[model samples]
Target: MEAVLPVEVEIPSMRVLAESKLKEAEWVKQCYEQLNFIDEKRLTALCHGQCYQQRMARTFNKKGRPREFSPGDLVLRKVLHIAPDSRGKFAYKYDGPFIIQEVFDGEAIILNDMDGNDDALPVNADALKKYYP
Candidate 1:
């Protein structure tokens, strides 16, 4: 006489399966959070890039600044930004010496007239050259 045995398989319960699914969902949520952080970093970089171009144009292209001066400094201003029609003789001409009043964020320079009057105007640093008397 011979005896036969039936094959049996075991499977996890519903509770165990649900727990696995929860773990997977948590992992997916963590991945989404990381993606959000990356997106914010990219957005910040783009904003800075756009601003840098305008800043460079005002700073490097205008006067080709070598050195900068601070407030209440006596400096010469070479007016190259003046229109050609303004100066009948020349277009890229340097104006008489001026005194610096205040520097605004490396963009604008408030300075007095050639005679050092009280009236001050904000001009680009490139338009005015520092005068060392």
Candidate 2:
């Protein structure tokens, strides 16, 4: 009813500023792409180095002894427990010197105690280590 100040604000200047900022951002992005682009020699070297390291690591497994077990072989089973009240850091990393009762296709094995009771569950071969006295 009463005009104290100008009610209509100039909007075209704000739109023009926003469009100029968007164009500037696009130009900056193109400049960054040109500056930071990797050439063919560097790209090929990076990829070849990664692949060679992986292949070397895989082939280096021949240096370590592989885990294989038969029936009647003594082994130590890894016990993964998450007890909050444990005192030391090395509290019960492995449980027992369980005997391998049976081996199934190199995937899993049945374990038993010294008394020949099948009280433990079947464990994967990766979880068993040779129990050397």
Candidate 3:
């Protein structure tokens, strides 16, 4: 008769298991630290972007002069486009020697034609300059 041999299974030692668990914990801690760093960097970048936008706006605004107009002022309106069919390139850039009939807050003005007829719509002072006739 042949004798049967029993098989033995190998198991990791407790020290090895403990070391692996410690390594996993350390890796998780490092990942959390990296996530925190990324979040802080994003927040800092957002603040910097906002500050840059505000600074640019301030600088641009500094270069612009406010247009002021009062009733009875003579002003010329900027001609954006004349009838396309007439005087294509030779058309004057500004149209009116219109009179300011009424002035409203925030640079809004009502204009009157030379014949003393009020314009149908209010015009922005920015679009009109002192005619200096």
Local distance difference test values of all predictions, in order: 0.65, 0.74, 0.79
TM-score, structure 3 vs. true: 0.73
Pitting candidate 1 against candidate 2, the one with the higher lDDT is 2
**24-130, model 3: which lDDT tens digit per residue?**
77656755776778888899999999999999999999999877787888999988668867687887889889999999888788999989988999988788999
- Lowest summed-lDDT stretch of 10 residues in model 1? 1-10
Per-candidate RMSD vs. true structure? Answer: 15.0, 13.1, 14.3
Number of colliding residue pairs in each model: 3, 0, 0
Q: CA lDDT of 118 in candidate 3?
A: 80
Native-to-model Cα distance after best TM-score fit, residue 101 in candidate 1, in Å:
1.0
Candidate with better TM-score, 2 vs 3: 3
Model 2 C-alpha lDDT per residue in residues 4-99, reported as the tens digit of each score: 333222222334435446677765665566456547658989999999999998889768777679999999888766588876776888868888
Worst 10 residues of 2 by lDDT: 3-12
Best by lDDT: 3
Name the better of 2 and 3 by lDDT: 3
RMSD of candidate 3 to true structure, Å: 14.3
Tell me which of candidates 1 and 3 scores higher on lDDT: 3
